[model samples]
Every structure is written in structure tokens, then in C-alpha cells.
Target: MVDILMATYNGEKYISEQLESIIGQDFKDWKLFIRDDGSKDNTIHIIDNYMKKFPDKIELIDNYNRNLGVKLNFGELMKRSKNQYCMFSDQDDVWLPNKISITLNKMKELEKVYDNKKPMLVHTDLKVVNQDLKLLNKSFFKYANIDPKRNTLNKLLVKNTVTGCTMMINSKLRKVISEIPKECVMHDHWIALVASICGGIGFIDIPTILYRQHGNNQVGANSNSLLKKLIKHAKDFRYRFYTEQAEILYRSYSNFLNSKDSRIVKEFIQLRRYNCIKKRYVIMKNNYFTNVMLNRIQMFLCC
Candidate 1:
């Protein structure tokens, strides 16, 4: 059975439509597990109403109601998952009917090739939509210039292409993320890094969900122009956090990482100590560059 882990906070506006989409899925063998992070709005009340209607298929994990933020909230839900396959859900996005079936099928194929004990992740593209559910972009990956195929350990450390809402993980991958680090850029990025290092990651080119973008979105698609994106990246780049995240990865999974992987993580962490030119050189030498040219240039200049 698949366990759908959804973390909600102030999602009253679109939560019902999201729930309806999940309930109408063609794949029936799944249970929805929701945890609210102390929302001030009527989000919890709406969830309670849904719980009354589909008590068998949906559950509200009410034991913890404190606010742990999004990353920790999802981390707690991951810890409570007790199924073979697990998928992350956003309270605002509408999943396509075949999302579970397609993702699970790809996950099963990955399991057949790699042992069941090996960690694996399967993610798909998404359709970018406005708050009103109008299609803003046909493909999220194209909209963001993300190449989901570039999912190696070194590559993912620089840029994460996997979106949590569109991804499914095996129990092994779930175990790999036993504790979410405070240094993690995001839960999905951390999970992708673990899967890339520990086992494998697969991707489906098809859009699986309507990724809604709105004012309240914690993180949404960036449809800015090239110049605007470059200026924004230059202004907001936090080089220290990336180094800290690498250090955490090296410290946490040193035993599982091979010598090459260990060296890559070490080099990435050490980039902060080098001169700007040397930093750019090391990034280029190690091929730690994203697919987007502007972002890669920014990384070279900022790091």
C-alpha cells in the first residue's frame, strides 16, 4: 500500500480541491496521512470535515499539533509512514488521476532492477497553474529550466531538480532520511541527495499534478525573465548554507559514501575557504554546475 504524507498549514483556500483530487485517484490502495503545523486558519476544521467523510481512507495525525515548519513537519510525517511506498503531497496542488499508479509503477520497476533494500526515488514533471487553477505553463520542468535527468550526487548538491510534491520514495529511502538536518535546503533536496548517494533516482517526463502558484505558496515556480532571475539569484545566494549542508551530508553518511563521493562532498565544503577564482575553478573541475546557464554563472561568481 502507498502512504501519502501531506503537511498542511493555512491551506484552507485550496485544501478541499486537493483532497478531492486524491480521493478520486484511479489507484485505490493508498491511505492519506495528514499533519497540520498549527495553522491559525480554518485548515484543521476543513481537514476534520474530510476525515468524517472518508475515515477509512484518510487520517489526521493529531498527536503533534505544534509548529515545526514545513521541513520538520514533513520529516515527522515521514517517520510515521508504515508502508512500502510513500509520496509527499502539497495541500494546494491537484494530483492527476494517474499520479499514484504511474509513480508506483516506476518505483516498482526500479525495485526490480535494484534490490528492495536499496533506496530509490521516482519523480515526475508538473503542470504549473495559477491560484485559480488556470494553466500558466504546460510543463513545470520547462518553466523552471530543470533537467530531472541530472540527478547525480554532485549535481543535486548544486541544484535540486526533484519537486517533493511530484516524487515517491521507497521505504529504504525513507529510512535514509531518519533525521532531517537543520542545514538541509529543503526536504526534497535532502531526500534526492540521499537517494543519489545511497541507491538510484528515476523520473517520469509526464506532468503528474497541477502545481498551483499563489501568494501564500511556501515555494513556487519562478517565471521571471533571464535578467530578473540573474539579479535575484545574485542578491539571494547563500554560499554558507550550501557548504553547511555539504558538511552535514559528509558527517551524516560518511560510512555509506564511497571514497569518490566522500571526496566530492569534502571539496564542496572546502570551496568556501578558497579564493573566488579558485572557487569557480573547483566548481568547474568537479562539474558541480546546474543546467541553467544563468544560475551556473551566478554560482561561479557568488561561490
Candidate 2:
């Protein structure tokens, strides 16, 4: 059985569609753990309505507590789950009918091939969608062809190459995530980083979910324009460096004990992160350095 962990706050407009999508999954042996992170709107009301209709399929937990961010929300859910398998859920995204079945099959395949002691985390590519659920010609499955054994810090440095909403991680990985440094970025990235270190990640090229992008996006919209990315990089430094992303990656490099090729790539990333923290003037002075700094800042904040 699968437990779908979702955190919602003022997501009334889209929560129902997402909930319906999960409810309609071809894989029926799953439950939805709905937790509202202090929603000011009818997000709770809408969920309450749905829970009334399908009490067996959904469980609502909305005891208003402190406004814990996404990382803590996820960590809290992991602590509460007793299932052997758990999947990350976003408040506004709709999963395809076979999402659970496909990911579960992949995890079982990995389990057969690798040591049982190896912590398992499997993720699939996702199709991007708008608030209205219109499909966009993009995916989070770019790393589908990557060799799990060859996964390295350097590959992770060039790009995150991981999508959180589409991930399914085993409960055994819970301890590793619980112990991750709080400064590490989003839960998805943190999980990906930990997976890279402990066992390895299994990737699926199939698009399993409609990853919705909305106005109050915690990770913002997924746009493909290079010019737009360049512009946003300069504007969102706080979203980048101060977040868990920078620290998690830094820790990954610091803890990496693998191939020299990957280690060297991570070293550059770590050095660059270190330089930025020290407020390296060399990066600020050079035009190209400024661009790199801006890009780093953007990634740190968004991840």
C-alpha cells in the first residue's frame, strides 16, 4: 500500500482536481494523507467535503500548528507513515492513473537487483501543467538515460535533475532524511542528495503526473526560456543561497567518497558556494562571474 503525503495551504481552487486524480488512480490500494498547513481559505472546507464523501480513502489532519515550511512538513509526514512505500504529493498536481503502479514496479525491480540494505528512492519524469491542467510540452525526465551506478556529485552539480512531486521513497530512507541537516534545501532535493550518497536513485522516463504550476508556487513555474531563467537568477538570490539546497549540496560534496571525476566537479561547486558565502569579490567583479553568481543564487533559492 502507498501513502500519499500532501501539504496544503489556501489551495481550494485546485486541491479537488488533484484529489480526484489520486482517487481515480488505477492502483486502488493507497490512502491520501491530507494536511493543511494553516489554510486561510476554503482549502480545508473543500477537503472536508471530499473526506465526507470518501471517508475510507482520505484522512484529513488540519490541527493548526506553527507554519512549518515544506521541508518540515515532509519530515513530519515521514515520521507518521508506517507504510513500506511513500510518495511525495503536491497540493495542486494531478497524478496519472498508473503513477503508483509504475513507480512501485520500478522500486521492486531495483529492490531485486540491489542489496536490500541499500536505501531505495525512485522518481519519474512529470508533465508540466498550468493552473487549469493544460499540458505543456515539457518534462522532468531528462535524466532517464543516466546510469544509476554512475550517478555522481558532478552530474548533480550541472543540474538538479530530480523532481520531488514524482518521487516514491521507501520508509528505510526515513532515518537518513530525518538526520539530514536542516539547512539542506527542499525535501525533494534533500531526498535526492541522500539517495545519491546512501544507495542510488532509480529514474523512470515515463511521465506519471501532471505537475501543476500556480501563482503561489513554492518552487515557482517551470519555464524553458533561457532569457527568462537568466533574468530570474539575478532577482532571487535569497531563494537560492539561504535555502536548504545550497547546504545539502555542500554536504553532499563534503561527504562524497567516490570517483575522482565526480569529486572534482563537486569540489568546484563547493568552492563556488564557499566563495559566494565569503562574498568573493572576484565573482562580483567579472561579468561572467556575476552571471554564475546570479545563476547559483537562483538555484539555491528555488530548489
Candidate 3:
């Protein structure tokens, strides 16, 4: 059996659709646990109405008025789930009927392959959507090369490739993730980081969920237009520079390494020095930049 953990905060507009998607799933052995983080709208009303309709399948927990950010809310959900396998759900995303079954099967396969080792988390590709549930594009995870090894602290430092809405973490992972340092990044990123540390991380390349992108989206969805891309870059730069949030994530990972093994901590310290701001300048100083610029100019002039 699986427990679906969903956190909500004033998501009345799309909650019903997302709930319907889950309720319509072909998999029968699952329960949906929704924790409302003090929504000032009819979101809680909608959830309560659904729970009354399907008392056995759906349950709602009133989280009062605590504005626990996304990471904390998700952490709370994980801490409360009472199942062997837990899947994270966003308030507005619509999952495919096979989403749970496919992810659960993959986790089962990985368990068999890894043998005595603990199971790692499994996440699938997502189909990006708009507020009205119109499909924009699929999140093709081809841009970054995913390392298959268990220890991927080095690889994860480059980017967070896993999307939370499509994530299904094992119970073992859920038990230990709460111990992650408070300075860590988003929950999904932290999950990926820990999964890389504990056991093998698996990915389902096909899209199994509709990752809705709305106006109130905390983290902007991936964009393709040049202007939107630049705007997103600017926003990220502002966040990273002003809050130094990425550094918090780095240090938490560093702490995790220190607790795991001293050698990894030392290596992480060295990498922080080499791969920090100075590393970008050092790479640009090499002849690679000159050759790239010359090639770009030649191509542009010919065009």
C-alpha cells in the first residue's frame, strides 16, 4: 500500500481536479493524506467536502496557520505518512492513472536488484502545464547526465534534476530525511541528495504527471523563450546572491558528508574552493573562451 502526501495552501482553484486525478487512479491500494497549511480560501472547504464523499480514501489534516515553507511542509508530510511507500504530491498537479503503479513497480524492481541494500527514491519525468491544465511541454531530462551511482554528492552539486511532484520516496528514506540540517535546500533536492548518498537513484523518463505552472508558483517552471529564460536567470541570481540559500544547501551537504565520512568532508571543502566563484573565472581565463568566441563570431557573420 502507498500513502500520498499532499500539502496545500490556498489552492482552491485546482485542488478538485488534482484530487479527481488521484481518485481516478487504476491502483486501488492507496490513501491520500492532505495537510492544509492554513489556507484563507475555500481550499480547505473543497478538501473537506471530498473527504466526506470518500471518507475511506481521502483524509484532511488542519495545519492551523503555520506558514511552514515548502520544504518544511513537505518534511512534515513525510514525518506523518503511515505507509511503507510515500509519494509526494503538489496541490495543483494532475497525476496519470498509472503514476503510482509505475513508480511503485520501479521501486520494487530496484529493491530486487539492490538486494540487501535499502531502496532509493524514484521520480518520473513531468509534463509541464499552465493554470488551466493546458499542456505546455514535457520536462525532458536530457540536458544533464544523471550519474547512476549511489554516491552522487559531486554530481548533485551541479544541478537538481528531480521534480518533487513526481517523486516517490521509500519509507526508509522518509525516516532519515527529517534529520537533514535545517540549512538544506528544497525538499526534493534534499531527497535526491540523500538518495544519492544512501542507495541508487532511479528515473522514469516518461512523463507521468502534469506539473502545473501558475501565477503563484513559488519556483518558476522551466522556460524556453529567451526573455523568460533571462528573467528566470535574473530571479535565481537575486535569490542566490541575496539569501545565499545555495550556500546553505552546500553547507548542509558538507555537514552530511562530515557526519558520513571525514574524507568526503575534506574533499567537499576542497571542491568549495575550486568550484566556487573562482572556478568560473579560472575556466574563462583558459584558451577555450577565445576559441568559442571566434567560432560564434564566424557563424554569426556568415548568417
Off by over 4 Å in 3: 140-151, 179-181, 218-303
121-238: candidate 3 lDDT, tens digit per residue: 8988877677887866665343222322322554353346677888888877776565544555677877887776655578877789987877866244356675664444434422
Candidate 2: list runs displaced more than 4 Å: 62-64, 138-151, 179-181, 216-303
Could you tell me every candidate's TM-score relative to the true structure?
Answer: 0.95, 0.75, 0.76
Candidate 1 colliding pairs: none
lDDT of 2 by residue, 53-128 (tens): 9998788865556477777777667766678888989888888999999999999999888756678889887776
Against the unseen true structure, what C-alpha lDDT does each candidate score? 0.87, 0.68, 0.67
Best by TM-score: 1
Q: Which has the greatest lDDT?
A: 1
lDDT per residue as tens, model 1, 1-303: 999999999999999999999999999999999999989999999999999999998998964558888888898899879889899999999999999999999999889887676899999999999899999888988877788988998888888889999989988888887978767999999999988888899999999999999885624336457677777766655667777888898899899899998888999899889999888888887888667586577865584
lDDT of 1: 0.87
Clashes of 3: 0
Query: Which prediction has more favorable lDDT, 1 or 3?
Result: 1
